[model samples]
Structures are given as structure tokens and as C-alpha cells.
Target: MRTALRPHHLRWTGERDLAHAIYGTVVGTAAMATAGAHRTLGGTVATVLVTVAVYWVAERYADALAAAVRGPDRRARIGRALRQGWPTIEAACAPPVVLVAFVLVTGDLRAGVVVALAVSTVMLSALGHAAAKHAGATRLVAVGCATGSAVLGVVVILLKTFLH
Candidate 1:
């Protein structure tokens, strides 16, 4: 079981981080728009819940993926698998944390959520590339994902502006 959990653990961490970014952005935006400091507390709570949910979902996904990759001798390979996966996890998670912090501080929740989603998507793609030994692919994927996210953000903002 432990062995089966190793590979996907890092990916799960990344996903949880992504969720934190999203929750932080949403809560912060709500707080800022409503002129209520108490919204910060709510945002914090949302962030925690989102993070926890992300962790749980990511953990399950990672375990399943690891199990698929590891096969019968997965237990024996646990340490090696963890060692290999840790860096990818770290790489995937770091950007979202920084971006979330920036969004929260700047009170730009919408942009933050879009960026976070984009980053999360790119990171997932990078992880796939990591497994395949194609580092260059991650760069392209990130750019594409980020561009798409930005477009979505703009569209959302425009719609909100016009509709409201």
C-alpha cells in the first residue's frame, strides 16, 4: 500500500496547492468586493477546505497511477518511486503557491484563479512529460495553458461586467 502511494503523492501535493490558489483567489475577491474584512476569514476557510479536497483527490489519483505503473513489485519500489517523484511534485506545486499569494495580496481573485487553473493544467501536462523524459514539452504546454487561461479570464471578466 505504501509503495502504491509513492508515485502519485507528489502530483497530489501539486493539485492541493492548485486548489489553495483557487480558494484563496475566490475568497479574496469576494471579501474585497463586499467591503467586509470578515470575508478574509471565510476565504481562509474556503482555502483550507479546497486544499484538503485537492489533497484527497490527488492522493487517490496518484495511488491509482502509481499502482498502474508499479505493478506487482510496487511495494519493493516505493522508495525509488518517491525519490523520483518528489522533484516533479515540487516543480508542479511551487508556481501556483507564488501566483496565489500574489493574487490574494493584489485582490485580483479572478486573474489568480485563471492563472492557477492554467498553471495546474500545465503542471499536470509537465508531470506527464516528466514520466516520458520530455522536459521541453512542458514549456510549450505551460505557454499554451497559460494563454488559454488568460483568454478565459478575460472572457469571464467581460461577461461579468456586461451582465451585471
Candidate 2:
């Protein structure tokens, strides 16, 4: 049972970080693009990738810092922290992919932002539902939690609209 639980534990941490990075990147990109912060799709993609890398480094350092508080007797693996936070990079790819595809196919940056936001919202809901299931939530509770998580995505959309 203990061995079985370890993988689940690892996933929980990685998923949380991934979800956070996804939502942040989606919202940030949408807001910037809508506000005309980036003049080109290439520039927007660069900003998104840089944002993800910055967040990953911040989280990795945070994990190591927290572990350090527990002292040298329980050594922290800085490499493990890097590995655990790697999902952040994966999650950030969705927005750029959407942005590039829409820009190329439709030549509409606004549409790209909108579609990317929707994609990120869906991913957030899925992440939340999975998290609830991992916690053994009841069916209804899991759905409620998922909707709740999705609200964060909605907030991003609202901000983008207003910023635009």
C-alpha cells in the first residue's frame, strides 16, 4: 500500500504545479495579446516560454528552500525539485501551440487568444477532476471541485476581455 501510494504522491505535486503554470500562462498570454503587448505571434510565443521558464525556476527554488528549513539531516534533492516541476513546462506548451496554429491558419491573433484560453480552461477542469478523484472525492463533489477550478480560467478570460 505504501509503495502504491508513492507514485500517487509524486503525481499530486507535479499536477498541481502543472495546473498552476497552465492557468498562469494562458491568462498572461491572453491578457498581453489582447492588450497588444506583443506585436507578433513569435514575440508572444517567446514571452510565454520565458514566463514558463521563470515560473519553473521559481518553484524549483521554492521547493529547495522549504526543504532546507528541515535541515541537512534530511537532504533535499535539487534535481528532484527540478524534475517535479517539469510539468510546468509541458502545460505551458498548449497556449503557444494554439497561438501559432490560429495565427497561421486564420491570421487572427484575437481568435488565437480566445481558443487558447478555452483550451487552458478545459485542461484546468480536467486537472481538477483528476485531483478530486485522486483524493477519493464523491462524484458530485469531484464535479463541483472541477467547476470551482475552472472559475480561475474564467477570471483570466474576463481579464483579457477587459484588457482588450
Tens digit of lDDT per residue, candidate 1, span 30-141? 2222322223434533553455445545654675567658657776565444333233233334434645586768876555544544554444444343432333436667
C-alpha lDDT score of every prediction, in listed order = 0.44, 0.68
Alpha-carbon runs more than 4 Å astray in model 1: 1-50, 53-96, 134-164
Show how many residue pairs clash in every candidate, following the order shown: 1, 0
TM-score for candidate 2, please give it.
0.77
Candidate 2 residue runs with Cα over 4 Å from true position: 1-35, 73-76
Tens digits of per-residue lDDT for model 2 on 33-146? 454467677777777777667766787789877766674643546555555655566666776788789889999987877888788777767767777776788999989978
Instruction: Tell me the lDDT of model 2 at 149.
Output: 69
Give all TM-scores, in the order shown. Answer: 0.33, 0.77
